[model samples]
Target: GALVYQYPRRTICKSGTSMRMECQAVGFQATSVAWYRQSPQKTFELIALSTVNSAIKYEQNFTQEKFPISHPNLSFSSMTVLNAYLEDRGLYLCGAREAGDAEQFFGPGTRLTVL
Candidate 1:
């Protein structure tokens, strides 16, 4: 079975800080990874997508400058939440997919809190 794992289930930071989280894919070659943010309001936003050997694509409200992603290999990826803020507090999820499937398997996610 394939699985994606994210570390440090939860984190708390100041209003102007940052946090880094990791995602690792096991039992599959994760060709693409999609990053998403779920706010306290329960709204989910697609942040970006990272594909192996291809340029990363960011969604409309997201940018490389704000949510930078690192996809060094087929099995692992990471992202940093820069400049933590009250509005930036949310659950960050990493979804991994194989080469052919448009669907992705998501990790439990890392919950972030800003104060």
Candidate 2:
């Protein structure tokens, strides 16, 4: 079994600033971490997937330059939102999975608010 914990649960930042969020996996090895953003319209968008010892794969509209991720080991991961803006305000989630596992354990998500 696996469990993920993300923090800070909610955050507020001024426009044009940046914020970093972290995700941790417990009870199992997290071979991969998938970052996602849930939009205001309640749509989940895949941001990127980071696998241990492999390159991070970014989705179509996502770039590593904007959302740099760090997955240095099996149980920890973090990502930074560069230059926060209104459009970037959303709930950021990290789903971690073990190797060869189809089920992902999701964190409680980091809610971003830009003003």
Candidate 3:
């Protein structure tokens, strides 16, 4: 069984600031970590995916410049939402997957609030 734990379940920051969130994988080796954002009234958007020993892949509209990711090992990952704004408000989720796993284990997610 794989489980992902995300920290700072909810947070609020003034506009033009940055916020960092962490994810930890337990009960299995996480070969890949995917970051997603579920904005209000919209479906989940794939932010980025980080694989061990490989480059971090960012989806369209997302970049390392704005959402930097760090996957140092098999069980840990982190990402930062740089210069947060109203458009960045959403539920940031972390999904960790092990080798050969069909599905990823998702954390509760960190909700972002910008004012």
Candidate 4:
């Protein structure tokens, strides 16, 4: 069994500030975890993916400077957006792909509002 959980559910941040979010895994080991941001346009943008002992892979337009990630163990991960802006506002989702599984289980996501 694989399950992913995200925290804060919703948040409001001031422009130019930052916000942190967490992801937790339940039932089994999370071999890989992916972070995504769903834009206002309804497009899901990949932020990064972390695998044990391997380098984190970040997608285009996403960098460690703007979005930093931490995968402390097989069952947990966290990410933070360093700056809050109008364009940065979105639903942040974390998906955990369990060992030997083809599907990635997703969390409820963290909805962000920039003011």
Off by over 4 Å in 2: none
Model 3, residue 33: distance off in Å is 0.3
Off by over 4 Å in 1: 100-102
Whole-model lDDT, candidate 4?
0.91
Off by over 4 Å in 4: none
How does each model score on TM-score? 0.95, 0.97, 0.96, 0.94
Cand. 2 TM to true fold = 0.97
lDDT of candidate 1 over 27-62, digit per residue (tens): 888999999999987877999988999999999989
| Residue lDDT tens for model 3, 38-68 | 9999999999989999999999999999999
Q: What shift in Å separates residue 61 of candidate 4 from its native position after superposition?
A: 0.3
Q: Cα lDDT of all candidates, in order?
A: 0.91, 0.95, 0.94, 0.91
Candidate 1 has its poorest 10 consecutive residues by lDDT at 99-108
lDDT of 1: 0.91
Worst 10 residues of 2 by lDDT: 96-105
**lDDT minimum window of 10 residues, candidate 4:** 95-104
